[model samples]
Target: MNKLIDGFLRFKKNVFPQKRALFRDLAGAQSPTALFITCADSRVVPDLITQSQPGDLFICRTVGNQIPPHGSAPEGGVASSIEYAVHALGVQHVIVCGHSDCGAMNAVLHPERLKDLPSTNAWLKNAAAARSVVLENYVGLVDDVLLHLLAEENIVAQIENLKTHPAVAARLARGELQLHGWFYHIHSGDITTYDAQAGRFAPLDHGSATATPPRRIYHFSAGDAA
Candidate 1:
């Protein structure tokens, strides 16, 4: 508590003042270009990872970067946030990012270890598909390697889930928005983007890549609607 308080005090005394003009400009209005969704883990800082400043990215953080499919359950915060980002803010891109060593993925990978976290256990039910993908595809890998693979697979899974939202689907259909799946390697400072054509996540800088354009994800588009 004291450490958090000290951090806040330091922000107030040093950081906030230095960025006051930027904050003041952002105070009136914001027109962020992307809706970045990721885990609620302390180590994953969306802005820091993207090198973005305030007003550049609208963000939503969940336990496992899970976005429930549309119409599957009662409308929730994640749904509302996605709707607002697309329809209201007119964000061009929606990025679902997952990272290595994610506790949520760990819970799914080892449900037996989550005996005490009932709420978390319930929340992670959304990631069942992701768990199955990892188990079915990469059965033998364990520890960091297993977790890393699961993290990448989870991002791809969530991107599919994001398409289930009505507004997102409609926008995508009309070529008004784009969706992206990214896996961030926390330990190596590496980032991988899902290649729809190759059906895999490849290093962002992989030259001579045959991956589909980042704009044409899952047959969705970002141009004027028909």
Candidate 2:
């Protein structure tokens, strides 16, 4: 922990002074541009990868970058954060980022390894659909390739789960929100974004927007109210 403390001291003495005005403006309130949801892996630093300032991105991290579908657990941390970011904070973008060589993904691929981690295994059920997609569809692939496919599919799964949130669904209906799925290569420091048109993850281009396909809006029919 000394390293963290020393880093904080350096920030306070040097970086803090440099960005004093920015912090001052953000002291009373914050208006971040996006809601970044990613794996809780140390290597996937959201701000560092995005090069965003303190008040730029509101982040939520979870193992495997999983997002439980809405109503599965309404009071859950991820659900609450999504609601606050969209309804309260008015963030326009919600990103689900997964990384290469993710330990959580590896665990998903090998469930036997998680027998001691009951809670973790339970939580990873959120990615079960992704696991099924990868295993059933991508046959004959090597272990490493399968792991990578699981990570990518998990990101896509989480994005679909994000839409189930009431806040996200409502905003999406109005064409006000955009969803993005990202894969970050830990070793190479490369990022690829899901391209709806291409139906694949493509290299991220600076100054360009990479968004998920249009979401299906839920219509509440009057007859169903009976």
Candidate 3:
């Protein structure tokens, strides 16, 4: 843990001092613009990827970036965070981001491997739909290709799950919020966004803006599955 303590020391002595005024202003209150939901993977840093400053993105990191669909549970942690971000913090956008080499998705794709971690197995049930969707649609894919597709499909599935939240639905109804699905390529630091218009994901050349998308999350119909 010395490494972590040293890192904090640097943050306090260097980074924090550099942004002291920003931190001082933010100490009183924060009005972040978006709720950034991503995986617990250490490789994917939201602030680093987006170049966002403190008080910009209220982050929720989960294993596999799993978000239970609304009404599935009475009071899920993800649900509470969503409500707080949308209704209380007034975050204008919600992003469900998945990354390559996701251990959570890897385990989901091979449930047999999670035999020892009962809790992790249970938590990932929130993403079981993505697994089913992939098995039915991506019949022959394997290895890295399978994992990559799983990560992408998981992002799409979680975004749909995010929409099931009542607060999210209400905000969208009033045209106050937008939801986005993102696939972050870890090795290259490239991000691809869901092209709601094309019914697929497209490479975000630089970045994307927060606006009401013309379309929403894509779910594979029975026929669409392999």
Per-candidate RMSD, Å = 4.5, 3.6, 7.7
What lDDT score belongs to each candidate, Candidate 1 first? Answer: 0.83, 0.91, 0.86
Per lDDT, the best of the predicted structures is: 2
| Prediction 3 global C-alpha lDDT | 0.86
TM-scores, one per candidate:
0.86, 0.92, 0.89
Better of 1 and 2 by lDDT: 2
Sorted by lDDT (best first), the order is 2, 3, 1
Candidate 1 per-residue lDDT, tens place, 98-136, comes to 888898998888999889998788878888887888788
C-alpha RMSD between model 1 and the true structure? 4.5
Model 3: lDDT of residue 115: 99
Sort by TM-score, best first. Answer: 2, 3, 1
lDDT of 2 by residue, 1-226 (tens): 9999999999999999999999999999999999999999999999999999999999999999999998884329999899999999999899899999999999999999999999999999998999999999999999999999999989988888988899998998877788988999999999999875676888888644556544656667999889
Error of 3 at 160 (Å): 1.0
Clashes of each: 3, 0, 2
List ranges where model 3 is wrong by over 4 Å: 206-226
TM-score: the better of candidates 2 and 3 = 2
